[model samples]
Target: MLYQVALPLIPQVGGGTARTLVNYLGTPEAVFSAPKDRLAKIPRIGEVLVRSILANKEAALRQAEEVILRAEKEEVQLLYYTNTAYPDRLRDLPDAPLLLYYKGTANLNAPKVISIVGTRKSTEYGRVVTEQLVQDLVKHNALVVSGLAYGIDIISHRAALKEGLSTIGVMANSLETIYPTVHTRDAERMLQQGGLLSEFPFGTKPDAPRFPSRNRIIAGMADCTIVVESTSKGGSLISADIAHSYDREVMAVPGPITSETSQGCNQLIKSLKAVPYTRAKDLEELLNWDKALAPASLPKPVPALDLSGFPAEQQQVLRVLQQAGPTHIDVLSRHTQFTMGQLSSVLFTLEMSGLVKGMPGKLYGLV
Candidate 1:
């Protein structure tokens, strides 16, 4: 655990690099202990990063120990990328944080997760739409995620709480303090239902640059990201863009063209970057949440598949998909225990064979 926490602290060691080191060297501790010559030989581990690892080993471990102690004192959970508790949605994302500081009881991998994001300067219409959307989502038993900033973010969280739904607030700063201090009380209330999550460790301030990094987490951790309102530019649009890049479902509320706050959403719709969100039903249809939430007894028994002609890997993927209905690639990888490369190859073959179809948000289902 100490080595897991320390690996990310080394400068220039992003999530992808850290994963590569762990994959090649066998473990974080092994990566730290490897000789400089050996480390340099690994792909992409240049002289500078190798030197940084060797020079900062002890300091990084010390910092990691302190971080662990503070996290314990604050009752925050340290979610390493490889930990079982870590979010699977983020597990395969190239830029996902290697470590997260989470304080909450809600399941991070809830079957239905949606992030609602928008401008800090929100209008009454935005608030109403956000609240109504959350309320309607209660029937689907969805978990809500948001940045917990002012305006629509807070409105969504509060609405989720009122609707008896769990809602997670992704933070740009550490768990030690909530930004926009006014939301502190609301955040505290969330600890009982959902909770606050952050990639930043304790004492890390909410600097300007950290918010965009924070936005990626919000985008990566959910199946869909909905922008309720925004101007031509704002953090919410940034979150939407990040979500789109991740191949996650992105939705934008269509507001009046005359309204300044609607410009960003209108532009996204015009560009075909996002679907127009009018109500919760749009989300349900996009994500197939209605079918997912249907009573287990109601599903028709799947007919046995004749997979004899397919390769073993393809057969395995088909069986899982048959049982799981629409599944994300990450989930398929976990169930099949296939590496991404192997899973992609098998899925590609099945797709070309007309046995599988791709769905929104990187999901795959029977054709």
Candidate 2:
């Protein structure tokens, strides 16, 4: 679609005056090409909006042309709501984005798309659980989607790439600018591996308010939204709420009962709004993969642990740590009935092996 048609629809772009102009002229292209009396006949658009449209039209048109050219060069496909490529799930939403820019390998309407979402500050447990779930879903030909935030979002994307699965990162910013700056490299990688999608115009920054709006897209784009972990109140919960409003499945993995990070998931399950996601099968079972996948039924992922580099000693230490969290050295020694020296050495080896992490004041726990 032309910017002459698109730019005026930008609610805040032309301020209070433009809404009237759009109301009268029906579109900016009409306003731009209309005579002065024709413009004057509009309710409140006579002077200001007409002038704004007249002055801004050529420049807006030029910028729109540049966006189209950039999209062509970058291999990013543009999807207006009226276009066939626009996701059917999002089309019915009340406040859907006017346009979506995409670059990727898979179809936007892929049947098995699942949204993976969680807290920006994810714990080690959250990381493992999120990656494991993504690995399973992707193995079954599900498109793993997320908001491209830090923590769980980045982890899922990287894991999906490692497994050669399709990944989608929906951004709060525009195609020209990336949010959180740190993930620019991964965002670029996603465009090559899958794609980066956005509703914002070019050069839009990640303003704080835009995030909740962006979460709606992440919610709307998926058949189901899975929360790996979240705080009591956070973006993932908002996404889940929106998913419910859209009549999509909302699933969450339970964390430790004592964990502050797990509160969100627990609350969601407690409300009876979402089901506990214990395994990938739980998701697939409800997803009705036989119908979604049709003739190209997805192959189930092999349920197995990857222990390629784990040493026997390190593995034993991890087993002990898993059995008892925050174990004091003496307690651990007694529990395992190993000598203090053996336990100390084991902890050190485990720390170095990345199987265990040392907490504040020398407390050690399995990572």
Candidate 3:
């Protein structure tokens, strides 16, 4: 755990590079212990990163130990990316954090997760729309996720609590303190139902640069993200952009054109970048929540596929999906022994043919 948490803190080991190192070396400890010459030979990893790793190995490990201790004292759970408890949706992201410090009762891997973000200077109309949407989400037993800031963030969290739905606040700072101290009490109230989560360790202040990375979690952890209101530029729009880049569903509430806060949503809608969100049911329909709500039953055998004319690679992927039963894309890649690019092409073809279904969080199932 120390190695896992500390390796990413290396000067040159970013989330993407960290994952690459683990993929190549099998573990953080091995990555650190590997010869510099060998490490430098890996694609994209250069001499500078190798030297950085060697030079900072001791300091990074020491910091990791301190952070782990603080987490233990605070009763916070450290979620390593490889852990089963880590959000599967987040794990699929190439830039996912190496570890997350979470202090919440709500399951991070809840069956239904929806992220809500909007302008911090939200107006009453935005608040009312957000409240109604969250209220409607209650019936579907959705877990609401947000940044826990002022305005629409607080509104979404409070609405979720009012509806008895668990809400997660993904913080930009450490779990030790909530930004905008005025919302601290509300954050405490959230602990009764949902919990606070962060990738930053203790003593890390909420600086300007951290929020964009924070927004990625808000966007990545859910099956879809809804922007209640945003201006032409803001963190909410950034979250929507990240979600779209991740291929997650993105929605935006339509607001009056006269309002600046509505411009972001309008632009997103106009550009065909996001679905226009009107109500909770619209979101539910878009996500196919009814299918998710159906009773669980024994896994069925994959239906027969007449792939005589299909390429061997596509046929191989179909057979793997047939046997695996709604497997994650990573697992599909491993089972089929196909590269991500190959797997994506095969899955796209199957989806286009109506032979397979793509679920949120990079899951695929036979149709």
RMSD of each: 2.1, 21.6, 3.2
Candidate 1 — which residues are off by over 4 angstroms?
A: 293-303, 337-348, 359-362
Rank by TM-score (best first): 1, 3, 2
Top TM-score hit: 1
Give me the displacement of residue 222 in model 2, in angstroms: 0.4
- Candidate 2 residues lying further than 4 Å off, grouped into runs, are 3-5, 13-59, 290-367
Give stretches of model 3 more than 4 Å off. 291-316, 319-340, 351-367
Candidate 2 residue lDDT tens string, 262-303: 999999999987889998777766665533445766555433
Clash count, predicted structure 1:
0
Ordered from best to worst lDDT, the candidate numbers read 1, 3, 2
TM-score of 3: 0.89
In Å, residue 28's CA in model 3 sits off its true spot by 0.7
lDDT tens digits, residue span 1-367, model 3: 9998898778867778898999988888998789888898888888888889989999999999998888888899999898888887788688989888899799898878999999999999998999998988887888999999988999999999989999999999999889989999889988889999998878889998999999999999998999999999877999999999987889999989999999999999999889999866677677777656679998655457776887898888877776666776766876787767888988998899898899854678888
In model 3, the worst 10-residue window by lDDT is: 298-307
